[model samples]
Target: MSIEVGSKLQGKVTGITNFGAFVELQGGSTGLVHISEVADNYVKDINEHLTVGEEVTVKVINVGKDGKIGLSIKKAKDNPNPKSGRHKSNPKNNRNGGGDRTESFEAKMNRFLKDSEDRLASLKKQTESKRGGRGAKKG
Candidate 1:
């Protein structure tokens, strides 16, 4: 069949790489399901979700002009509203998955900026101190 964008099709996993899995779609067309598209959550390893010779349902998210088809296994699944962005919860607890996030996105961003600035300032101070008093003792 013709592989078009937004079409769901059954494909066989022909190869697995660190970045993504190559799926052979109907009509002998091969597509790549990126590692990030393998699951709803973070997928550091594509092999953990898919393997060679495995049949999976993939959605044709994109089709490049150069014959490259981009597929998404997670998108093929029936999810009315898929969550976007990194799914990290409870920043203080340092755990993943859905958890109580008392802080809003803007609050979290501001907190991160403050922390980052503090760290950068400390680093600058340390470096300046090291270089300020030392300009080659005798050279």
Candidate 2:
């Protein structure tokens, strides 16, 4: 059977790399399932999710003119509860658009400056104490 875009196919993973997994499709065709396509969430290591000779269902995402096939295992699975993979933004949280505000910019800046000065003073005191102790060390 010919591999077509958007078609789901059963295949066996032939090889795996840091980037993606190579799956052998029907008629001895091979395709790449990128690490990003392996799961809905972040995938740090492709090896943890796939291995050589593992059977997987992959959706054909693209067919390049160079005969390269891009596959996605996550897309092949039917998601009953569909939701965006990333966090959705709330209109109420928009600062530039003038939504809600408890403090003005100048007030916030003053508060930040005060906190920074406090932290810097504490750090300077700790270092000075350590330095004084070192200078007073006997030979």
Candidate 3:
């Protein structure tokens, strides 16, 4: 079976790396599922998500000119439950239901600046407190 782009097939996990998992599809072809395609969330470790000899349903995302096959376990699963994975309106929540729409660039910068300022002020106060205590040691 010739693997083509957008083809869905069952494959066996042949290797696992920090970045992705190697799958052996039918017809003795192999493909790589990037870390981002391993799951709907942040895949810190591909081994934790997939193991050798495990069966997975993957979609052929791309077939490079050099014959490198790109597969995605996430893309194959994304459309089945589009609304189910939608994240709720909670900024602090890290749950991976699906895609996340974060603040705009300007808004993010503003938030970052605010947090940074708070941290810097706290650090300066701590340093001053330590410096003030150092003088008491000698006196």
The lDDT values for all models are 0.85, 0.88, 0.83
Candidate with the larger TM-score of 1 and 3: 1
Q: How many pairs of residues in model 1 come into backbone collision?
A: 0
Whole-model lDDT, model 2: 0.88
| Model 3 lDDT tens row, 30-104 | 999998888876778788888899999999999999999999998887475453334535645533344245658
State the lDDT of candidate 2 residue by residue for 31-62, as single tens digits: 99999999987899888888899999999999
lDDT of 1 by residue, 22-51 (tens): 999889989999998898878988877888
Between candidates 2 and 3, the one scoring higher on TM-score is 2
Q: Give the TM-score of each candidate.
A: 0.63, 0.64, 0.61
Q: Stretches of candidate 2 above 4 Å error?
A: 88-139
Candidate number that wins on lDDT, 1 or 2: 2
Candidate 1 has its poorest 10 consecutive residues by lDDT at: 80-89
- TM-score between model 1 and native: 0.63
Give the C-alpha miss distance for residue 83 in model 3, angstroms.
5.2
Model 2 backbone overlap count: 0
- Position 7, candidate 1: lDDT: 91
Q: How far in Å is the alpha carbon of 18 misplaced in model 1?
A: 0.6
lDDT of 2 at 52: 96
Measured with C-alpha atoms, the lDDT of residue 124 in candidate 1 is: 85
